[model samples]
Target: MKKYCFGVDVGGTTVKVGLFTVEGQLLDKWEIITRTENNGENILFDICESLEAKLDEKSIDLDEVKGIGIGLPGPVLDDGTVLQCVNLGWGKFNVSEKMSEMFHGIEVKAGNDANVAALGEAWKGGGKNFDDIVMVTLGTGVGGGVILEGKILTGHNGAAGEIGHMHVEDGEELNCNCGGCGCLEQYASATGVVRLANRYIAKNSESTKMTEFGEDITAKDVFDLAKEGDKGAVAVVEQMSTYLGKAMASIATVVNPQAFIIGGGVSKAGQYLIDAIADVYVKYAFPACREAKIALAELGNDAGIYGAAALIV
Candidate 1:
């Protein structure tokens, strides 16, 4: 007689699923590889099969499931159609409709991954106490989510919290996957950090600890070297922080959320990254906005599933 819901976070390489109680307690979780080669339709079949196996193994009845929520990597239209998923090669698919059919009429809700992550943080992670929060994921590319008055803010085109695509530099061309240049993502994301580091090394080859790693270095390697007091690494970190802070400042001017929660792999850089970025963020922000609290995301990699669960809760 216990009520439960399933939260599915669909990524390019993996699909993470979490079983949660109606009250938001995560009871069990699992993941499966997402095979997109057979077309997007096969992905749903694999997920349905995986979910059935997991539920059977746990002796959970399908009747007890209240709903299924999904967090997708691309933009979802207002009418429950997915516009496109560049990573998944899915375009204009009816995700929610397909999911409901797969689950035999169970209720289903779908949203962008960043928005779900923000909702997850608001429900149980870093933004637990605040009704207004902005969550930023600084990974391969930057992604953002906005929660206002306890609701996810999806704009007219369902692309509301796309802070990464915000233009930071005017008339300065830098290639972005969104087909634009000078995007904030190009400077503030982990990919951006590596790009900046590589550029620095290309120009200052003899003056950097990056020279030790040859041509193939990563953002983590840069952070490690920075911790070791490498001058070049330190410079890269500072520059990265400056750009990140600048982006935060711009975000603050618009949304002015109560808190900014930073997540994703790069966030593991810890206080070194946070403190440095905050130092510059305060300098660039407006008087009242500068007081906004900055914090690290508590959920780690599981944030997506938790966030998806939040949609139902």
Candidate 2:
């Protein structure tokens, strides 16, 4: 009987690898550098070497390993074909097939990083109790994943849960990294919060504490001030919550997830942020969807590995 499995989350700078029991308990975890040189040709080789070393160190035989699940920073089709991953210098290819070949016929599964993270949450994190959930990661940029009936929903092109690029405003001059204007990522992400704070400070000469941080102001600072009842900071936080909540409400109408799990660096704001966004979410959400729970992700950074393992475990 298979007793173990491996989870690999490939990011731009590093790859997080986790070894787990067939029963879902993590046995070991580590990280390896992601060599993006030569179009990331060495990425798989590096991961394979790392896993081999790990297995050898643990004295685990290949016969006892079940499978390997990998999450990539790009759109990944159901068959494990990655359309593109510019950050990793990767192009269209069957990642699962390649990795399986490198692993000498071991089973391998693949998925988009964000979606796999959501799957991890659904399987072992905040949304584990719920059958359907939408996970929003408010980091440098907004990332999202949808889990329906406990399955990752990777739309026709593997871009199903890209809630960050959902248009939230009109007539905006600035373009998001995705080449879109007024996207949710532009106003709801960590940088988006800073942008809102800066825009507010620039427009209204408010004698607020935010100015103390000056140009280095971050999303955490904004939230801290907002929690302290600073008017300008409150406005900025409210605006961001409004955009995020409204976008989630729109998503509710379509997927009607049972919950929205907020994760990432920004989620460190804690329950206060959840309450603030929940207030706006209720107002904008359909009456039937208003009951959806808004909670913080419990898995933190581990969600990616857990979700990746879920692909095959």
Best by TM-score: 2
- C-alpha-based local distance difference test score of model 1: 0.85
- For model 2, the stretches where C-alpha displacement exceeds 4 angstroms are none
Candidate 2 has an lDDT of 0.94
For each candidate, what TM-score against the reference?
0.94, 0.99
Which segments of model 1 are wrong by more than 4 Å? 170-173
- Model 1, 62-127: lDDT tens digits are 898888888999887655678888777788878888889988888788889988888898888988
lDDT of 2 by residue, 120-165 (tens): 9999999999999999999999999999987899999999999999
